[model samples]
Target: MKRVLITVFAAFIALTAAAQSPIVQAHLEPSHGILVGQPIRMVVTVYVPNYFTGSPDFPEFEIENAIVVLPQDRPANSNTQIDGVRYAGITETYVIYPQQAGDFHLPREQVTVPFALAPPKSTIAQVPLPALAFHADVPAAARDLDYFLPTTALTMQQKWSSPMKNLRVGDTIERTVTVTATKMQSMLIPPLSLDAPSGIRVYPEEPVIHDQKTDRGDFVYGRRTQTAKYVIQKEGDYTLPSIELKWWNLSSHRLVTATLPAVHFIAAANTNYVTELPPESEPAPIAPIRHRSLWKQYRSRILITSLCCIAVALLLAMIWYWLPRARRRLQAWQERRRHSEATYFHNLQRACTQNNAAESYVWLLKWIAVADPGVSLQQALKRADNPLLTSDTNDLGESLFAQRIQDYSWNGKRFAALLRQQRKDHRMHLSKHQYLNDLNPK
Candidate 1:
């Protein structure tokens, strides 16, 4: 009977290994060299037999020195039959932008997928699929441009409610510039700079961005609009400088420029403007009389008073600049001390749970040092003079450094319990003192 059971178990293992495994594959799109800061696509696919129901859990990827972003788009799913066997599969894509010009490899990872293989799909099994890897490089061509983005097409246009011609002082004109790019994200587009001629005050609003896709959702396009309100300051002729955007054209395999035309306008003074002048007045001449001794008598006292006032002002200014900074430094120091104390205590507890006598002793010493730098663990235990804590520490020490055949066991549970009780009592006493001090602070 035992032999038969062993044979059946071996057959089960063989069946699972041969018949239930899913096909896993990975690849990089546009799999060659790409410019730095240009996005590359990583695709992972899992094909399971039709008997398996449900999807696979794709792993999250994080690469050093590269920006990896999970695609917001949904994964593609399909069903196909190959060699008279039906299969279902899903494909997931991720976007990555290399930050530096160097070779990088995405490591392979095994993923476990949960699926049901029976009718009504009640029973489930987790199958580990094969790992996948990808490699790419940023070549010397990437260093030629400071900022690079590959796109299919780009366009820019400026629109306004009225023509920018023959405007008066204080007149305001609103102009909008819109940029559209195909097969690219709006965030990759650099900010547009529009230089304004002298005598024009420009108040610009935030740029509005929009992303859209085709009806079939195959192609994506992004639009960004920047608006500004230009106010005529001095009445003179001015020209709005031309704006140009340089982008790499994917189809043409070269750089192209999208241009916005320059605008010229005349701002004339308002004809009905009026100017007011101050009223004219004739002043009477004063006869000069001076008391030189009276001025000299009080000059020394006045100078002394002014000097004292200046010294007080200087002291106040110094205090105003440095008091807040000193307070912040003090706060930061206290926070660090609190965090260190908490971490040391937690390490002690963890060491005790693992029944590591040497580690526990070291963590106990560290906790005492952080809590009160002047006290050692042995000294603290003696000063507390608690029977339970002292006994527990003695047992732990003996277990760590025993002489009789090393036949000692550390009671971690009892030690931890006694330490917790001691800490609770210490906190209560400390809190009482703090409360009393707060009531009558000196």
Candidate 2:
């Protein structure tokens, strides 16, 4: 009887501890029929016994031969009942793209969760995430292609910077090609080859690639833009090669090809075209004797002139190097001073001295903001408790918003004087308060 009781007591304690511990669950969506360069969703859910005091710390991890994307949206909240006990849960999603066909495994990781054990009592728990495995393979139909693109939709567009119909030997034209794909990454799109005929010169620019995402952080589409400039080197009719991109359509499960048509144009010989000429022939050997005679006669003057030229060149080089740096420093300093509190106060005083009601009101608001942040202008005025300042400010407002502007006139000078007096009184009151606080210990 004693042995049986001891065994039952140990079993009960084990069950109680298991009930209080946190739980972690992970799984993949569409676990079968995954293709290369396709995105898969990985959902991870964490649950605590009572309620969560703070969000769970989900770790970011990487898998070999694949691209991992962390959750872009906030965690989804959920509640579930397990073994007759309620559990509060949060779910976070991840996106993974396999670059090649292989088996991928997600290693175990640790997640920290903060939750309330009871009302007003909180604790943190470290939960272990279980390992997950998945497989990706290339479709037999897409095996022959050099690059694999698995998407629901794909499109290609072309634009020219100028008309391609003109016939000129020295004229140049720019051609831009844009490729857009749905449910794929921009980096997976292959580059377009812009090869021109032998007679034409081709200069290819760097390609621009980006992806667009929805508000919840899901990828909407990917776009790739390429540009090339063609210059007409010789006069003749030239034909540019066409471009074709092959991709696998995920919806139809078939291969699709997007093409841009070829371009043909005629180039006529330009009459105004000028060819580079050979450099002038060097002076004959016999001419150096005459040059040497002249050089000997003015050698001292030539030396002096050359030294002066060198000094001037040095001075210009120094100024060229230092001028830009000095200008940037000066501009930065001026910007800082322009936004200072003292500058705003000075502007207010100037506006009030000129008796410009509109300008004075604008500067008054600015100065008040710098003086006391989070306190309204009316509140500050009430705290000052000055009847004259209040009356002048009211008159200033009337001048700004009155139906008839000529009906009311404001005295900015009196307002400025009263404002200064109120500031002095406030400062004196603060000094007295500080003195009293220092005199008595708390």
Candidate 3:
């Protein structure tokens, strides 16, 4: 009987041990690590606290906020079963690429988690995880006698389109350039200037910094683009020389430069058509002399000349009365047509960029109706080109809309992000049309 009691006691102890066999731990390396951009990483371990049981999946975590005085790009990466604990040990990495060369730190910040415990208890507090320290490196400036020489390996790219690719004299051409990089400082990039061809006028588009990202806690990548316009004043094939862009590449620790291929364009001649009589087939036969007196000939010629003068004067008077009225009518019709299409296109462009899947569907239908006047939303959805639009009736109008709870509206963050991207892209396109408009209050 005593032996049986001992076995029961040992069994209870074994069960309890199974319940709390593992624990959770966290860490990162070289806390004072130097990264040109923001770099983040995590270490995970499972600790059962000597009495807790049955580790479930790892708990999720996030940094509440991060601040860096130095320029850096920040992004997050995570992987699990790493540094493994049978129940859990996970690591996450965050990287930031700094734009300026200087020292920066990730101050003590809060880390938050709302997770399912193994048996799912509510609000069991563990000691707060300590914040790790990180340092960011910044860009270095070059002091050179010839500034044209780039000091870094940063590179540039260009893209262009002309609304009027083929133009007559007095027509305009639009050109654009897009620059992308992973480790460039703006100060390292040289200012742009164009040496436009004779008879060509160049108007620059505003340059915009589009989007940026950091990778592996050390490198930064970003896109910058711009547009320009030119008017051709003469008829001929014209060529523009290759454009050179200079930048400094910190990674390579040297001057780097790239040149775009040269460009060629043509203008057409303006031709005029005039109506005239063909040469006579044969010389007029000599007219037999009329036996008329000189006074009769003079009288006939005078009468004919007076009639011609009177007819010409009547024609001039009619044109003076009707020309201005015709010109005004034509101008009014043109302005009205322009306004109608302009408003719709601008609105439609906005909707596409916004990605309000439902609103976009409605706007797209409206645009189709403006074009064909027969496409209903349902029918249009079938033919729409954008993949964001879905055909599933369950999703109805919600495919590309961000996932949300009982959403009657799109997700706020998603909509806001989509809108911001659109606004930036729209501005970039607009900037392609230089000196177009600046909405600055000042």
Model 2, CA-based lDDT: 0.82
Q: What is the C-alpha lDDT profile of model 3 across 304-384, one tens digit per residue? A: 888998999988888898888888889998866754544544565565455544444334333444543443444444443
lDDT minimum window of 10 residues, candidate 1: 115-124
In candidate 2, which residue pairs get closer than 3 Å at backbone N, Cα or C atoms, i.e. clash? Answer: none
Name the regions of candidate 2 deviating beyond 4 angstroms. 1-4, 118-120, 275-442
**Which regions of candidate 1 fall more than 4 Å away from where they truly are?**
1-19, 35-41, 60-88, 93-110, 116-146, 213-219, 271-442
- Candidate 2 to native Cα RMSD, angstroms: 16.0
- What are the per-residue Cα lDDT tens digits for candidate 1 across 167-254? 8987889989998888666766778876688888788999998877544333287788999999777788788889988777767667
TM-score of each: 0.50, 0.64, 0.36
Error of 2 at 42 (Å): 0.8
* Model 2 weakest lDDT span, ten residues long: 400-409
Cα lDDT of model 2 by residue, 1-442, tens digit: 9999999999998888779778999989878899998888989999887655445779888988888888853566666778877787778898888999989988788898866666335577888888889999989998988889999999999999888887698788999999999988898999989999897889999999999977655668999999999988789989898999999999999999999999999999998865445568998777444445777899999999999999999999999999999999999999778856678778878879889765676567557766765444566677878887888887975665443447665788888788778767877999999999999869
RMSD of 1: 19.7
TM-score of 2: 0.64
